[model samples]
Target: MAPPRAEWLASSFACLLLYGFWGFLGKLALVRGLSSSQEAGLEKLGFFLTLPLILKPSATDPNAGPGLMERPKFALLAAYMSGVTAAAADFFYTRAMMKGDGGAVSAITASYPPVTMVLCATFMREKVTRNKLMGSFFTLLGAFFMARS
Candidate 1:
């Protein structure tokens, strides 16, 4: 079942705040001379630590659906690849932040939503509305200006 509107909004707000803190803390660590690899490794450790707090045993929890290995092969492949890609992206982002202005690097990376939109449209046959096109144009333009700094 889908979340209620309020619940969804609250979760979205929480994500926004957490992600904002994630970037700020990452930049702070990078500035303090943490190597990108170290930052990525430690960050991944923190990520793993969160899993036990949330994951419940399927045997005890009726809602705890199928185990990971029981999922479709394509889904598992996609999830695994996404983890790899996200880690690589985090590493590269931290490397960039080590030398570049955090704001500039973040702005450039923030432009990824446009790339995601385009990819979805191309690969998933998602509709491309005019509003999305205009938003993408403005988003890219803003990123370009920020990156020039």
Candidate 2:
């Protein structure tokens, strides 16, 4: 039931644009004198506002998974922990953005993929190819240069 390559690519492109716009909007909000905590709280509220759309079964695929409350306890715990961690990260990220240049904050945060790569390689036994290593090195180098801006 996987989507076609075109669909995947289109969705990824949309994600890139949406995330970029989101950060830009968030920075604008911070510049408008909103407290970081208030920004984070309102952001979570925005996420909640979209829950219905996310949870509803779509026309193309009706076999949506079980309800969140109906899932296994372990699954529920994992989901809850994921939200908790994301909320904490969002709070810290907004705090950083509020105190520093948005571009620098964003550039530094964009380097997080290397951490994910390392974690996957260590915990999930994922292969780290030479290309991946080179890409990560370049990404980090770019982040370093941008963070100095």
RMSD for each of the candidates:
3.9, 3.5
Model 1's TM-score against the true structure: 0.83
**lDDT comparing candidate 2 with the true structure:** 0.84
Give the Å error, residue 137, model 2. 1.2
All candidates' TM-scores? Answer: 0.83, 0.82
Model 1 CA lDDT for position 59: 69
Candidate 2 global TM-score: 0.82
Candidate 2: misplaced stretches above 4 Å? 1-7, 58-72
Judge candidate 1 against the unseen true structure and give its global Cα lDDT, from 0 to 1.
0.85
Root-mean-square deviation of Cα positions for candidate 1 versus the true structure, in angstroms: 3.9
